[model samples]
Target chain A: MMVAEAQINNNTINLLEGWEEGLDKAPEWVQSFRKKAADDVMKTGLPTPAWEDWKYTNLRNLESVTLCEASSLHVVPNISSPFIDLKPIIVQLFNGSFVGEMPDLPDGLMIAPINEVWTNDWFKGFVSSLSIDTPMEALNSAFLNDGIVIKVSENTKIAEPLLLLSTYENSKDMLSVMPRIVIILENNAELNIVEHQSGIGSYVCNQATSINLGEKSKLGHYILQDNDRTQGYLFNTTKLNCYDDAVYDGFSLNHGAKLSRHEIFADLLGERIECIINGAYNLISTQHHDTTIKTGHFSPNSISKQIYKGVINHEASAVFQGRICVHNDAQGTDGHQLNRTLLLSEKAEFNAKPELKIYADDVKCSHGVTSGDLNDEELFYLRSRGIPEIEAKQILTKAFVAEVIEGIKDSVVRDIFLSISIEEGTK
Target chain B: MRAQLGRKKESNYKMIKIKDLHASIDGKEVLKGLSLEIPKGEVHAIMGPNGSGKSTLSYVLSGKEGYEITSGSISFDGHDVTNMMPEERAALGMFLAFQYPVEIPGVTTINFLRTAINSLRKARGEEEMDAISFLKLQKARTAELGVTMDMLKRGLNVGFSGGEKKRNEVLQLVMLEPRFAVLDETDSGLDIDALKVVSKGINSLRSAERSFLVITHYQRLLDYIKPDVVHVLADGVIQKTGGAELALELEKHGYAEFEKNQSNGAVA
Candidate 1:
């Protein structure tokens, strides 16, 4: 008992108190990875406000919740998706474990559990190559129990999007879940994926996804985190690698969760590649959100663009930290980033740190950050047209986020996002 | 040539009455002790130089913020709207055609018009216009206003040319069918062809129940939509009132004569 108390004191906050025993059931390779991750986490613990990247987000709510590992969840909970009407193939991941049978697939497409694919050479190589940049990522790696792996063969084009719907619900003991997603597209392949995450109770969900796009490949990745607004805490890490002539267009919509931190790291590995990342979030009450991005331009003639817009109301606060690094060999690289937020209440706050580290002289890179209340001119214009004041504000707020949603290339996906954004942003 | 053939004479019923209108912006008085009246069925023009409070009067009448009425009252169609909100004033049939129409991105012009029309209808306890009926009315109004349907597809006044913006305002005036409209420098940026199209659209809305206050620096617009009375506004007050010929006279002599007379009268 004395040693346990001393260990807790040394680790600051030990989330592995009740969740460490079940991790032994994972495979040998994952067991080793988990061993190393556990050691690293014991040394570092979770992110705190002292960390520069987490300055504005405090984990006070997470420390009080007693989290335990979820048992083998075989019973499929009846669940519906936000895009259920679109009829896409829905793959469910309950309590960080992929459940249910694999849906029908077209030619050259593969989907399997990570436990089944851990022996594959490419899967081993990919898992070993992951860099743990933060304690949350280490926690995800440490407790890596069950996940999914999706691969697209060369020259394959998917007709319909695949929805990876992850749901976590615990009414009893608060659960901590870790889910990993690995996606790889061969040369000249194309795919669209919509990742939706949600939960019910005060659970801690830490998820990581690794994506690799081969030469001339195209991917449209959309993510929506609509967890329980008053309870859940989510930490997401997305690492992307792009080859020559590949395009990775990604957008995230965050309007849920009591606290969320979404970190993205994109590595431009090959020439003439294009990476576009855009996001829009609406936070109300005491909700807090953070988006931290790091894009490395390593090749010549690559382009990267990031645009984020959010509306913060009530006592909610949001943080945006975006950094673009252009290496010496990355000549002719074009990078742009912009973050604009609208504050609906005087107590609402937005903190932004936009940085550009360029060693290439010929690169064209710029960033901008703006935050303010709704434009009085815009509000007055709408009211002058006989719309009531409250309705006028709603219209302007909806319009503020319309640009990000409408920029989506796929019409169906665009419509879904547009409806959600309009609904949440106006409210 | 002034088009006086369709001009309506002033009636006994006053549609709008501005009494001793002393207003200010940013604590600096702009319209001091100014008074004007426009009876039903008649169109009145208020011509003034830059900073003569013509725009202030229009904004104040339309209930825009930042303009405080020090001590005056504005009544439109028998409703005292001094403390009313902008939308409330709009519901009372008061409209101001801005000199610079604001650009609202992401909202299509057609959507804006529909919302405005439906809001007005709802405010008056009428059922909102159905979509099909709105489209039909929009088709007729666009045709009458000489505005292309393509312009309505884009964001409201976003990327629109100066002429297109003025025409859109005129299109809105026709759509809303307000009882009182203030054309604030509606002809400032319009070229010859657009000026004629916008004036023709405004002329089509002229009725015995409607009134207008045309505020302009030049008399070019009065040539197309003839006003029954033209008032010379200088130094925050109306100095003279005359027939349609007054506009042509101001156009020829300019506000220089009015400024000189006002300064001379101030010295006395």
Candidate 2:
């Protein structure tokens, strides 16, 4: 395995100099957080195949490309909503920097760019609360280019979902961006958040979302990342902390980008918490997508479900690794995972690894995986009924991934995802 | 005279005429020197024991994969159709009800039927069925086939009972309304009631303008279908051609005598 310590160290040192120059914009502690996080990342470096978790995904290509840091100068690219009829509440970000215009938000909702509200006591306390760090989480905090914070007050149920769109406009250079997000829902509050990424040029989008759900609160987090550039890179890390009787639903669809990975972690800290994490990847030629999910059941009587479906097209590859860990005292835990892959061509490949580490005796956990190309009998059955081969392929492929798409609770968002993914498959 | 002319209208040349079809799967020959013809207004039943190549003959005509016809000619409605795709043959009004209807997960039965009918309509240069008309058409046929409304919303034949699967196939037969239909072992795993329902569905489509080729191992389905002509197939060729009485005779006596005769003929 090639070491990326030197490659990452150079970028971290350069970013530190930039952070010191803008010390007033950020507080003293934010600067220290950046420096300390950078040092931690420099020590650990990028993950290689030697690590069991990163076995199938290679980071050699990512480490070799020394992309430039994001500049403050922002230019909004012309991006229309893919869902024409759905005028969702939109929060736009350019190159990891917020485009701070005002939109009318409902009561009990507060959304502001983290940099603009860094001095608030809640922001400072929430930012400095966590101490333990993983390599990717440290890397995100070290070179944090921009961030957002959304706090929903207690007993509020928002009607419309908030869409946070981070677009990397026509890049003059190969840029690298790290966007951080923190969402906190108070007791009995409910909120749905959708994170979207779109761009036209070569760049690396590395971001982390940390969510905290108070007692009886509900949260749904969705990530839709589409980058068609062959050399682009996108990696997202989403972590959720759930309290008693809270519900958390996280879903992601990695439909574009030459290389992309979404790592999701959920911690069920209180009883009766239920979380469902489902995802799908529609990959094309020479593209690689990896989805890694882990859920820890720390309290008794919690439920966790993970389901993923991927279609690997010609010369494309995908990987799914899911693990459920039940602690010793976490009895009555139920965890189920199902991973399915459809190889669209002879050259496409899909690999799945599902694991369960349970130290409790009264837990129920199971995992299963299936992967293959379209069934010949099914195709012939359709063709024998008068459907042309082209249309037959489209129908069968769409049907193959429909089970996962139907997992999304919202009908409008479901329709948009369905159309985009089917369009991508047909092409 | 009017009824006769009505039958003659669709039988421009013939409903189906297959000559000397020699087919194989995976280098193993299944059909050798098989020939048959069906007129527009007749129902033909081909009965044979196991491995007698009855299903292979149906598959070759329907253009299924893995059944390669080395030397043959298949004519459908006067047009040579040996090289056509499955969809093309279907567009020409050829339908095959599979012995094992494929269980396609996530495809609703109603959606599948609509797509199939529209594609065929498009091929025939006819206007596609609108949603309202399609719903009416579907509800009427599904009600007759004893298919519940809930089954239409579920995946096509997935997790269905064997009787439900056969009913679904018959429902497709009712919806497609092809010029010629091939029912391959439609009564294989059916009970008496299911068989009656399926046979009723098939009987409803009987007309002077349509023909059927019922392939079965036993004479039970032939009893319900009442074919106009019956052929005893053994070793890939028709050993005997007779009226519907041939089915009763075969039901009384097993296929052991026919196998001996075919082997003796080959030896001679």
Candidate 3:
């Protein structure tokens, strides 16, 4: 195999300047962690297309774009309430920094800046135990300045969902904002959280979210990224760890960002755990989005599922990479994955790769992938019913992605995702 | 021998007329210069064996693509619609009850009906119906058809049985209230009960200004939906025409005679 030595190029180094100021006031361990991440970045550059996993994406695109660090000036936009009827605890983040007054959270729940919890033993241990897998994640850890930490005490079932609304705006030449979030739910706890990212100006939002679910806990996680398509890039990574009898349900809707990649890694470390990762993307106008997920079943009687669907229009492209690994001890594991995409134009493209590594003989695993245009029979049926050609196409396209959104277990959240998908798919 | 009829003077009563309509699919001719005419306020039934181009005729009438007209014209309500789209034909008060209703997995049946109704209204320059009004109308039309309100909430014909699909089509027919309709084997998979419900829906819409072309393979449906005329289609052309008795005769004797005559290139 021809090996291309991964080295940080000068252009990438130029983007990493002015990082010391952000880390000067951080705790000693945090500073060392950032320094080690920066050293790794200098030794091994950002991922190039030469890597097998990133063969379809090229980091060189970020080199030409002048992405300076986000300014200290806090320019908060007039944001609107979420389009859901259920009253949620709203937390707004401007340019990756937590802004606005903190709401009165319910008892047994805490939401604070990440730095505020840095001194706590559990939070410190969690931060120190993170092992960087990709160069992009290393870049995030190296320059991370602002983020929030959410924790739910044991046996606490929060009635309202927590909405993390992050908005970004670049006043100067393209800006880069790296935000990290950590969520911990103790035993027998349940909580629902949604993160929405939207902004106007050109910027790169490189963010990461790590979730730890204790035994008998349930967490419903949702990410809706509807950033400006022409002026932004998003790289979001989610790392999840589930203990015995823990359930991690996650869904993502991506219709924004000129280019984006949402990668997820879930570790079912204890028995009887359930992990569901589902998402839908509607892209148009030369936009690109990638969804990569890896689930490791280390314990028996665990279940994992991944369902992703996309609609690619006008020269837009998308990628879906799903990898499921069942260890020898993970007997009685049930894993299923499916990916489907609709290419609306001749120039639209979709690439799917499904990898399954099974070492357990008693496990049940299945994966499927399909990519095509709309069905002619279905289209003709709608048109014959007096629906115009254009409207018929839109209806069918929305229905195509709506099938995936239906996998969302929550009805209110499903409707919110459906409305956003309908609005975006029509475009 | 062609069943010839006397030509009538052009009047205000709109009719569907096909003149030497020839259509082909994939370079093979399926409708070979077929011609038929149905005046207003009449129900005509066409019976044929398999591969006799009955379905092709229905598709051609609704302006489905991939079927080259080759050399012919189709006109409805004094308007030339040979080159029009399926939706255009629908806007002109034309409807087709498909033999097999398509299953749209995520679009609910009620939403589909509302969209169709609103689109037709827009095309006709009329006011669109709101949700409440549309629901009231739908409830009224579907009340006696044995279609429960729960079916409307489900996806369009997604997991419906054969009878349910046919009932849904009849429901659409009643809701749309088109001036011209072509029922393409609507009785193919339905049982006796569904046939009556469908027939009732069709009979309710019969008026002096509306016409229908019912395409069927069996005579069972004709017992419920009485037709004014019956035509025998064979080898892509109409071979014979008679009164309602013709459907009974075809059912009793089978399509053997028609098939024999079709091979001989005979028209009666």
- Residue pairs in candidate 1 whose N, alpha carbon or C atoms collide under 3 angstroms: none
Itemize residue pairs with steric clashes in candidate 3. B1-B267, B1-B268
Question: lDDT by residue for model 3 over A206-267, one digit each (tens)?
Answer: 88888999999999998888788787888898889999999988988888689899989899
DockQ by candidate, in order:
0.76, 0.82, 0.78
Least well predicted 10-residue stretch by lDDT in candidate 1 chain B: B259-268
Docking class of 2: high
TM-score of chain A of each: 0.94, 0.92, 0.96
| lDDT tens readout by residue for model 2, A28-78 | 788888778767767766676766778898877764565676766555555
lDDT of each: 0.85, 0.82, 0.86
Roughly what TM-score does model 3 have, to 2 decimal places? 0.96
The window of 10 residues in a row where model 2 chain A has the poorest summed lDDT is A11-20
The estimated TM-scores of all candidates read 0.95, 0.91, 0.96
User: Model 1, B116: alpha-carbon shift in Å?
Assistant: 1.3
Candidate 1 stretches greater than 4 Å from native: A1-13, A18-22, A71-82, A421-427, B1-11, B261-268
Q: lDDT tens digits, residues B1-268, model 3?
A: 0111112223435499999989988877888879999988778899998888999899999988888999999999999999999999999999999998899988989999999999999998999999999989998999978788889988899899999999999999999999999999999898888888899888888776788999998988999888878999998989999999999999889999879755533222
After superposition, the stretches of candidate 3 with alpha carbons farther than 4 Å from their true spots are A1-4, A421-427, B1-14, B261-268
Q: How would the candidate models be sorted by DockQ, starting from the highest?
A: 2, 3, 1
